[model samples]
Structure formats: structure tokens, C-alpha cells
Target chain A: MKTRVETVAIIGLGLIGGSLAKALKDNGFCREVIGYGHREPSLRRGLELGVIDSFTLDLDAALSAADIVVICTPTLVAAEILVDILARTEALEQPPVITDGASVKGNLERAARSACKEFPPYLVLGHPIAGSERSGVEAARSDLYVNHRVILTPVAENSSEALALVSDMWAAAGATVVQMTVARHDAVLAATSHLPHVLAYALVDALAESDESDEIFRCAAGGFRDFTRIASSDPVMWRDIAIANKAALLQAIDQFNEHLQQLRRAVVEEDAAGMHETFTRAKQARDEFAAILAEREQAKTS
Target chain B: MKTRVETVAIIGLGLIGGSLAKALKDNGFCREVIGYGHREPSLRRGLELGVIDSFTLDLDAALSAADIVVICTPTLVAAEILVDILARTEALEQPPVITDGASVKGNLERAARSACKEFPPYLVLGHPIAGSERSGVEAARSDLYVNHRVILTPVAENSSEALALVSDMWAAAGATVVQMTVARHDAVLAATSHLPHVLAYALVDALAESDESDEIFRCAAGGFRDFTRIASSDPVMWRDIAIANKAALLQAIDQFNEHLQQLRRAVVEEDAAGMHETFTRAKQARDEFAAILAEREQAKTS
Candidate 1:
């Protein structure tokens, strides 16, 4: 399915929202993209860069004129915004369809349920499996979501029309939309994305503040720096994610900590066989991951 | 100072030794380069790939005919080989100047002290700060060490001539030779190299063995895959490094675990400010690291 709209209002215009606006305009998926935010410089920049057709700080004005609204705030704040959006639209004759680009989906779903007293048929929860350590409208590009996966966790309360429209929008943006439960999405993302980030940040902070910081960093190689690359991601954004997806991320950290302890014990005891087995298993899995990625890349090209 | 030799014996015909052999031969720094290892297939591959001029199964013959020897086995095994080489040549009037590419230095120093009661004058502990996740002689390339740093840990007992000779050898292979104490080398490498490897291996192993592994791996993106790329490195080699650098690595792990637990507490308690502060620090450090690397890269190109 492909989607087109008369106008699209993008709330909280950062990298995610700005990119979506640019992509929508470039694909002619919408006649106009209205950027809604308090960041005057970025909003002005978005208008100047042609990423958005107009800019406004008035939420009501942007929402009333739009056929669709995409909330793109940090995860924790996005839930609050979702609640507010649902409440204010309750009296409308035909409310606009609403979707969000939060990394964690459960909080938004909960907020919607709390506000509406039932699942909001007009509201759909989605997460784009795309981002970078960099942020802001200044970094926006239309191709960010090209060939990326967008996971949509549509609940039973979601109207089929709304779900289809959201899916169509992502498809129009050059993304492959997939469906999953909110629980599954959070858990999988915890292990694959959030957990690695937590570990990387911990490693970087630990090494940087150590007594031998100078020598340690001087000897740090390119691979080691790359391993901690995600530590450079937006701090406030990650903080909200950690709080929003608390339980699953904690479980992920606990599981990884256990595995780390096992390896740590092997090192302490000088148990050569134990360490070798763990290392070999990890190597095999990582190698298989590389092969799968290669196959996926080849399929996309060929 | 630049030095040349009639023959150079590399005691382990793997990626490191083979690359050094090829580089030495390509630079015309030595008349003959010999590979000495028990892995017959890899030794044969080295010969066929022109990575080594010739190879011998007889350690005694190789050592006797060479003016220099480079022990390039895994860190743990390298210690035993060093001890054996030292003992076997104790009676020689002028034994070959010996160097090694073991990632850990303290174990070799301890092994040397235990066997000979003092650090041998002809031995210089060195580690080339270069490698890939891939292994074997077939992966060897002559330019692997070009523009890379190779740290040499030379003790007071090391003869100046022996240290100079080893420095010249690394220089001939296009590596920048830097000197530091053995303890500093182990501690710095523990935090920068060994600790990151341990964490990556643990993350990969934990995710692969979990029940949600299928979904986790399916959702894993390019960045996460590259985050664990070091986990695909040679298992036996990492295992040896873990055992050989046990004390320093354990200290590094303990420090990192403390930072991780602090961050975990912040997440569990929904302490946004605490998490934000830690994340901000980590992000700053990582950003600084990236800038440093970029500056170094610009210097290289300019």
C-alpha cells in the first residue's frame, strides 16, 4: 500500500521528524509538511532547507490543519504527548490519525490506553529501526530510512484503516514495515540495541575517567573506539529510552552481566577450557551474523 | 637506528608472523625470512603465498641459522616458548636478539624471571597494535603494520643493542615503535584492548544463548553487528590473552562493572538526571575520541 496526504504535521522536529518531513516532501507523499517545535533555530533551519513547507510553535494550529500527525519526541516525553493528544481530540467529529516514532512503543500504548479508557482506533504505535549517534534537523536526510525496517505494534484497538495508512506511509518512505507485539519489540530491541549501548557507554566512561586515562586512550586502537561508537548518541534521548523501557533493558543487562561474570571467573581461575568454549561460541554466532547481513545485502542488490 | 639482518626467524607462522616476514622480505631488510611453527598447513600456505622465504619444522635449526627471532604465538603460549628459547640459548656466546608480539607483557617477564632469575639481555617484549578478526597465514598482508603503533616494553636488564635491534626490526616493517614499562603496557592494553574484547564476546554469547535469540538477531542492525565484530576474532588467541593478563583485566572488569551497576540503578529507579549525567559524560568522551582520531587521520593524509 502507498499513502498520500493533504498535509502532514511533524511534532518535535529533531533528526527523526525532520527526516520524515523531507522524505515526505521529496516523495510527494504530502502536499505540505508543517514542523511543530520550540527549537526556533532548527525549525527555521528546516523551513530554510526545504525539509518542511512551514513552521509553527502552536500545536493546535498545526494539528487542526493536518491530515496526519507524527509525534517524534524522546520516548518518555512522547508518552506524555500521546496522552495529551488523545485527550484533546476526544471531542472532535473526525480526529486525525496519529502515529509516533518513539524507539520504545509500550509506554505510548499505555499512555493511549490511560487517556482513552479504551484502545484508540485512530492511534497506531510504531518504531523505525533506524537512527544514528548524530541528531538534530541539521543532520536530516531523505534517504535515512531507505531499505530500513519499521516495526509497527498495532493493538486490537487500532483501526484497520489507521494501521494500513501508517504501514503505507512507511512503505512510501522506502522502508519495509513489519508487525510484532509491543512486548516482543521492546525485548528484542533491548538485547540488540539498548544493551549494547549501555555496555558501550559503561566501557567508555570507565576507561576515560580512570587514573591511567591518558595512556589508556593513547593506546586505544580504532576497533576499540568503534566498539564504543554508540556512546556518542544523544544523551537525553537515551536517558528517556532507559526509563521508558526499564524492565526489559534491566533484564538484558542482568543476562549479559551473568555471562560476563562467567567469563570473568574463567579469567580469574585461569580456566583455559572454559574461556575457550565461551569465546568459540561467541565467535561462531558473530560470524553467522556477518554472513546473514552479507546475504541480506546481496539480495537487496541482486 | 636502522638495522639489517642475514636471516629472521618467526616462531609462529600465523597472521602476525607471516605479515612481518613478508614486510621484512619486501623491504629488503633481511636476506632470508624463515617460518617456524607446528601448523604444517599454515606454514605451507605461508610458503605458497610468498609470505616466507622458507620454513623449518626443526626449531633448533631455525634458531641457529637466524640472527633474529620473533615469537608470534598467542600470549600464553608465547611465554612458554620464550622460556624455552632463553634456556636453550643460555650457553651461546651471542644468541639472536629475540622479540615477541604477545598482547600481554607481564606474563612473559614473569616466565623469563622464573626460568633465568633475571630478564634476559637479548629479549625485548613488543606488541604490534594491528590485527583483524580474521586469522591464519592466508590472511597475511605485507602492509598490515604500515602506519600502526608497536609498543615495546623493555626492561633495565635488556641490553641497549638488543632493544635497538628490535626497534629497527619493527621500523623496517613500517611500524612506529614506542617504548614503555611492562606494567604500564599491560594495564593500558587491559583497559583499551582486552576489556573491550571481553565485553563484546560476552554480549554476543548472552544474546545467542537466550530464548529470544531468533528475534533478537533478526532485529539486530548494522551498528550492533559491528559493535560485536571483535567477538569473531580467534577464540584460542583471546582465551590466551584472558589468562595471561588475568590480574589487570580483572581490575578493569571490576571498574567497569561498578559504572554499569550505577547506570543500572539509575534506570531501575527512573533517575533521569543521574542517567542523563552519566550519558552526557560518556557522549562527550566518545565525541572527543572521534575528533582525536579524525585529527590523526587528517595528519596522515596531509
Candidate 2:
């Protein structure tokens, strides 16, 4: 049987939390979806859009009512909030299960570790591998996580019941649940998502500061625009992520720099063979990745 | 009035040449479209697909019957072919107006200058800023250049007749013809197109060579796919571009390296303010670029 919650308290109402609230309510996975945030306009918008049943400024009130609580703030903020949630629910007879939607998992893992000797049973650390460039409650939708992967990095102390409940909620919202170690999650994400964002931001920032900035912007075509799309993502959120996943991101950056040097040497010496081999290897990998995505989509619909 | 040609000889049967052949035929701008290439299968495929009306293995035969000749090959090859075309057509009563679709203009510029005291009046240098990840004659389509910019870099010796004919051909194919100096075109493209391609190729190649490549590959999502889309472009073509646009590209690379160093330092020191400022600037630039695109698209459709 699928697990259901009586109440789900969402600590933030940005895209991830707002979309989850909408998804859970749409699927009837929760009896009441209560939002907790400082922003009044977004909470009111959530209520008007039928994204949440109710909302409060009081974190205690929301946690008191919820059977499950999801912290969905930026990474550093989410880590701090996780600590507060752990402390506030310490004495309760049956405290709410807690999870988060932060991009980086190491900081959350550390926060959870600080509150427990081994690992907190009810603190089910997670990162739903789903989002859009748009943010906040205004952009929330039920199908946001459909056919997407929701990665849950469960600790040793995670209660089976807590894991089941979180998994069922995600499944109800049309997401495929996968498990990973927090360390592995951080490293993989640094290479794939965070690193790409950094390269794009650096490229754009560099070009913007160049002497020929006006001419540079005028000549940017479809490919340049597409490659830099992710650079337009939220700055505060990325800043938080860069800090939260610092070690792994730096490692990825260093690796990329070394390879870039090799490429630069080839270009400088006009090493046609060296450039061809690197490009060929990348093309094969990218093409394979594309095929995998296609197969996964086909599997979902099939 | 639109300029018309009796027979147009495309000296290469790849995407650019094939598409131009298709577009000209589709618009009735030319009486016959003849393809010149060494590959029999591709030339046959071009004929079967109606991308070209006739095929020729002999460059001399193709040049002999043509009112116009487009040397559309990889950059280096295009330069060599330009020299041969100049020599053959040197003794003709009225040499066909020549142009090319090479990405980098310097090589072509040098070739033209070597053959004449000034830029050959009959030779119009051009680069159409339109392409897909797909290439070759089989992937060609008539609408490839529609709504795209075709930049023509005319020299001091370019006759009014040659320049007008080349501009009219591009206009007939649904491209907006723009003019720039050879140096400006190379620099602008190095910053906008070549730099981004190098970064994407480097990122992908670097990740593919990492220890956790399997796990990293598994976690790559839509944004990674979109950012790396251009890395799948033909390696040989890019290699030629890298060598052909060497000086400008190296200058762009050196500039980018400095900015990347600043970003790396910010990340290493955990300078939240620095990271945020850079990301915000990039986001603002990206957003404005997006707005400009939307406006241009709106203007086009309206």
C-alpha cells in the first residue's frame, strides 16, 4: 500500500517546494499542505493558485501540524533550517520526518550528522533532480517532477517508514526515486550541473568585461545562447551552492582546467590530431548520453 | 531587383553548400545547381535528395559551365581551392563571381591577397551564421538559412556587381545580409562561437575522462545536454576552425583564462560576494540577450 501523510509542511515556497506542494495536493498524497515562509505575497499566491491548503509565518505551527516537513530553501539556508528543525522537534513524542530539496547534499549531511551520533532515522536527506529556470510559487506546477529522478541520499539511521513515506510522495507526483551516498551525489552533481554553470558564467562574465563587448554581444548566435542558458539561473542560489559544495566543485574546476590547457596547447601549436581526438571522445560521450535520455523517456511512456 | 544566375557551382557537397543549393533551387534564383565534391556517395545522395540538380567530380568541368562558384569546404581546404579557382578563371572572358562560406575569413583573405594586388573584385568573402549539430549533404534543408544572419566581409577591390550579387543570393535564401571587415568578423566570431565551442568540448572531454565517469554520465540532465549540444559538431570542421582562426581564438582564450582564474580564486576562498556578483552579472547579460532574441523573434513574426 502507498503511504500517505495527513499534513506536509513546506519550509520554502520557491519552485521545488511550491511544485511539491501542488503535486502532493493534486495527487491527494497529503490531507493538508501548509506553507511556512516570511514572504506573504508568495504564500497568498500559493493559496490563490490552490497550491497549498494554508500557510503560516510561524515555523513551530507548521511543524507542529505536519506529519512530514520539507525544507526547500537555498543550500546554506536549508542547512541552517535543518539544524533548527532538528532542535525544535527534539522533545516531541512523534516528531515529523524531515527532508530537503537543496542541490548540494554534503552540507545537509553534516547538519544531520551534528544532530545525531550515527545518522538521524527520520531525517531523510534528498534532492529531487528536477527544476526549471523559473522560480517561486508563481511557476509551480503538478507535472514539474513527472518523469524526473528524485535522488534520496539516505543515512544509516533512516527509518524504513520515513523512507517509504518520502518515496511514496515522490512516486505519487510521477517521479522515479533513486538512492545514493551523499558524497557520491555531491561529486557527480559538481561535474555535471555545477561545473557547467560555472564555465558558462565565467565565459559570459569574461566576454561582458572584454574591450569588444558590444561587438561580442552582437555576434553571439544560437549556440552561444543555448550553451549559456544555465548562466541565467539565480545568483543567490548558485552562490549558496558553490559554498555548500565547495570541495567537489573546486576539484571539478581543477580537472576541467587541466584539460583546457591541453586543448589550448593543441590550438596554439595547431595540433590538428590532438584537437580531433578530444573532440571525437566528447562527441561520443555526449551522443551516448543523449541516447540514454531518449531510452529513459521511452521507458517512462512505454 | 533580385540577381539571378544561370548555373551555380557549389564546390563542396556538405551542409552549407547542400543547403545553399536547395535554397536557391527552391526559390528559382538559379537555373541549375551543380555540386562538386570528391565523395561519390554524398554527391549521389545530394542528387537523389534534390539538394543539387547535377554532380561533378571534376572541379574544372564544374567551374567551366558556372556563372557563379561557391567554394564551400572546411576553412583550409577552401583557401587552397580558392587559389586554383582564381588561376583557372583568370583567363576567362568574364570570370564567374566567386564567394565562399568559410567560417574564418583570414585564410580566405590571405589567399585572395596573394593572387591579386588588392582583394579580387570577383571574389566575395562570406560566412553564414546558421547551422545545426547535424552536417553533410543528407542533413541539408532549404530553410537552414532562413531568419539567420549571413555576414559578408567585402574587401577594397570587391566590385559593386560582385558584392550585390552575393548579397542578393543570401537575401533570396531568406538570410539577412550584413557586412563587416575581415578582422572584425574573425574577432567577433572567436569570442562568440569558437570560445563557447572550445569550453563545451573541454568540459565534456574532461568529465568523460574522470574516474567517476559512469556515475557522472548517469546523472547528466537536460541542462548538461543542452550546454554540450555543440560539442557533437564535426570534429574535423572544428579542428580546421581552430587552426584557421588561430590568432583571434588564442587571444579570446587568454582573456577567458584570466577571468576563470578570478572565479576559481573566489570559489577557493569562499568569497560569497565575489561569486554572487559574477553570477548576477552573467544572469543580467543572459537575460538581456534572451529579451533581445524574443524581441527580434517577435519583430520577425509580427
How well does candidate 1 score on lDDT at residue A149?
Answer: 83
Candidate 1 lDDT, A149-240, residue by residue in tens = 89999888889998988888888787889999999899988899998988988888998898877667767787787798889888887888
Runs in model 2 deviating more than 4 A are A113-119, B26-28, B44-50, B114-119, B299-302
lDDT of 2 by residue, B26-112 (tens): 998999999998898999999999999999899889988898899888889999999988888877778899999999999889987
Per-candidate DockQ values are 0.80, 0.79
Separate clash counts for every candidate: 0, 0
Off by over 4 Å in 1: A1-3, A299-302, B44-49
**Alpha carbon lDDT at B123, candidate 1:** 90
Clashing pairs in 2: none
Q: Roughly what TM-score does model 2 have, to 2 decimal places?
A: 0.93
Q: Per-candidate TM vs. native?
A: 0.93, 0.93
Which digits, one per residue and each the tens of the lDDT, describe model 2 over residues A47-96?
99999999999999999999999999888989888888888887678999
